[model samples]
Target: MNDGTQVHLRLVRPDDKKLLEQGLARMSPESRYFRFFSAKDRLTHAELAYLTELDGENHLAIGAARYLEDGTELGLGIARFIRLRERPEVAEAAITVIDEAQGLGLGKLLLTMLVLAARERGITRFQCDFLARNKGMHTLIERIADDVRYGHESGVMQAEFALEGPEGLYRALAGVARKEGHVRPGSGLPKLETTNDS
Candidate 1:
């Protein structure tokens, strides 16, 4: 983060439903709107289940949390991708960062990790849909995707891009992570857990 906060990245588990709910409550209305594309006050039981209970191969989610001095972890952000059944090589990706953590490059870190996970699962392309007013998401995608094709419909913008090519998506994300100070000298990207370990 720009503020030098050390955030831990890990795979989300079923036990994290409450943590995710609390994180959603902590987000501002604008942040919620930008993320969910709606002014939702709470997540339903089914939605919570869908978000937390993930099969590492198809529906993968990575969570970010900052640990306080007292060892209490605060949820900061999440990035996930759900593989398209129709197109096994493609997936829909989404990321959400809390309002307080916005603009600190946490999103980019989460995205970089997510892309790595996606590649490991054999996903070669990513499709994203966001509100037209979500300029932050647009800018982030623009920075990482080389051949991004965009389409607009009913105030929503949909984008699709390949994950592998001459200009590797992973390389682009690594570059952004370095520029944002998330990558430390002599240290590679953070390790991501593939299991649902609590």
Candidate 2:
């Protein structure tokens, strides 16, 4: 992190329902709106289950956390991709960083991890929809992707980009993952692999 705090990243599990709920509650209204596209005070049971109980192949999620002095972990953010059955090579992706964790480069780290995981699962393209006012997300996608196509619907902007692109795309994402002083050795961002279990 920019402030020297270490963040740990891992595959999200079914047991993370409470963590996700608490994280959502802690987010600012604007953050929540940008993420969920609405003002939400809390997540319902079904939503929690759907978010946490991932199918691994079709739906995958990675979470970031900060460890406290007492060994408790604070949920910082999550990035996930859900494969489209009709278009298995492409997936709908989303990332959410809590208000306090925003602008710390956590979003980039999470997105890089998400892209790696999605590629491992045979996802070649990523599509995302965000509010037109969310310039941060737009900039992040443009910075890391190449040959991006965008469309506008109502107040939302839909972006689609290839995960496997020219050499510059690989370099851009690698540069983000290897950002100086942001990611350190033994920071707990693990290598992703294929799995049948959610």
Name the top TM-score candidate.
2
Tens-digit lDDT track for model 1 on 54-131?
A: 988899898888767898769999999999999999999999999999999888788777887788779999999999
Taking all chains together, the TM-score of candidate 1 against the true structure is 0.85
> How does each model score on lDDT?
0.82, 0.82
**For all the candidates, what are their Cα RMSDs to the real structure?**
5.4, 5.0
Clashes of each: 0, 0
Model 2: how far residue 6 lies from native, Å: 0.2
Model 2 is weakest, by summed lDDT over 10 consecutive residues, at 189-198
Question: The CA-based lDDT of model 1 is what?
Answer: 0.82
Candidates in order, TM-scores: namely 0.85, 0.86
